[model samples]
Target: MKREKLNEMKMKFRALSSNEGFARIVTTAFIMPYSPTVEELADIKTAVSEAVTNAIVHGYRSNGDKYVSLTAVMYSDGSLTVSISDKGCGIPDIHKAMEPLFTTDAENERTGMGFSIMETFTDKLRVVSRVGEGTRVTMTKRLSVFSK
Candidate 1:
């Protein structure tokens, strides 16, 4: 589906644990004007949380200085694309990392289902990572209109 883009907002913030909630709230508020369904809204929010959490807990994995950036764009087709990026240690094996029960920090109570959950909730989920560079998670979801 192709539609004209409406608006876009991108921001970079400190990769603090506290900012996870901030990501979710801003995502919800940003897409509110599109009148997304309750389910769609929840799905987007969950996806954002997982991506941001992964960057903070897995990507950086240390108490140091780093920034996580989030970019969101709204299309005329009622679809949104969100890209979450981190300049922390990148995943060595993206395929292995995306497995249902894979976690580098199991001792930290990580569920290891972040990627799977994101895929389930979004129309498309893509991850690109380099050993020394960083990782970027991009997701897109089409919001269906209410037909009541």
Candidate 2:
């Protein structure tokens, strides 16, 4: 079936802890209208937060000099796709990194559950990265709120 017109938005923010909250807020604002319920909005927001946190904490190694980019596109079929990306030290082993509770940093008490949480919240999750290049996380979900 043909999809509806897509609504798109893009943003770039410093890879800093403070921007994690901003990422969540921007993601929620972008996807809330398409979400079926407030719970879905919350889920997506948390997912985005995880993605941003990973970029700051892992990708950029808490280096505020780098930037994280976020993009959201809303499809006519009521599905929304959001992508969070950063140009920094890419994940060495995507499969290992995706493993639940497997963190590279034990000193920081990181659970290493960002990818896991993103997968659970959205209908689709994809990761594209290259060591020494960067990482991009894309998540898609069909929202019910826009049906009516």
Candidate 3:
């Protein structure tokens, strides 16, 4: 489909585990205007939750002082892209991190499937991280007339 920008928004909030729910709710609201299907809404919410949780728990190490940012863009063809970012300790290996059950913090019972989960729910997933800098996870899902 030809891509044309329809709507977009960016938000930054404190990186606190408590804010994870807020992130999920905000993302749902952000895309609700498009009249997404129940499954699409659930998928988006879960993806947002996983990304935000990773930012607060793993990215900031639960510091509660740093911040996590989220951005959403809608294209004319019924596609949506969501970007979740954090400016905390960055990932050392993007590949290994994407592996299932590979948790950097094993003591916390992390499943190490955050990346995979996001990838499964979204049509496309891209992760960029730099040590001591931060991580940005962007996922795209198609939600347009043709999809219906």
Least lDDT summed over 10 consecutive residues: which range in candidate 1? Answer: 139-148
TM-scores of the candidates in the order shown: 0.95, 0.94, 0.95
In candidate 1, residue 45 scores what lDDT? 97
Superior candidate under lDDT, 1 versus 3: 1
Residue 25 displacement (Å), model 1: 0.5
Error of 1 at 118 (Å): 0.3
Q: What is the lDDT of residue 142 in candidate 3?
A: 93
Q: After superposition, how far is residue 20 of candidate 3 from its true place, in Å?
A: 0.5
Highest lDDT against the true fold, candidate: 1
Give candidate 1 regions above 4 Å deviation: 62-64, 146-148
Off by over 4 Å in 2: 146-148
Candidate 3 lDDT by residue in tens digits, 78-116: 899999999989999899999988998888888888888
User: What's the candidate order when arranged by decreasing lDDT?
Assistant: 1, 3, 2
**Per-prediction backbone clash count:** 1, 2, 0
What does candidate 2's lDDT look like per residue over 26-95, in tens digits? 8777766654587788888888998899989999999998999999989988888889999989998999
Angstrom error at residue 79, model 1: 1.0
- Output the TM-score of candidate 1: 0.95
Report the C-alpha displacement of residue 2, candidate 2, in angstroms. Answer: 1.1
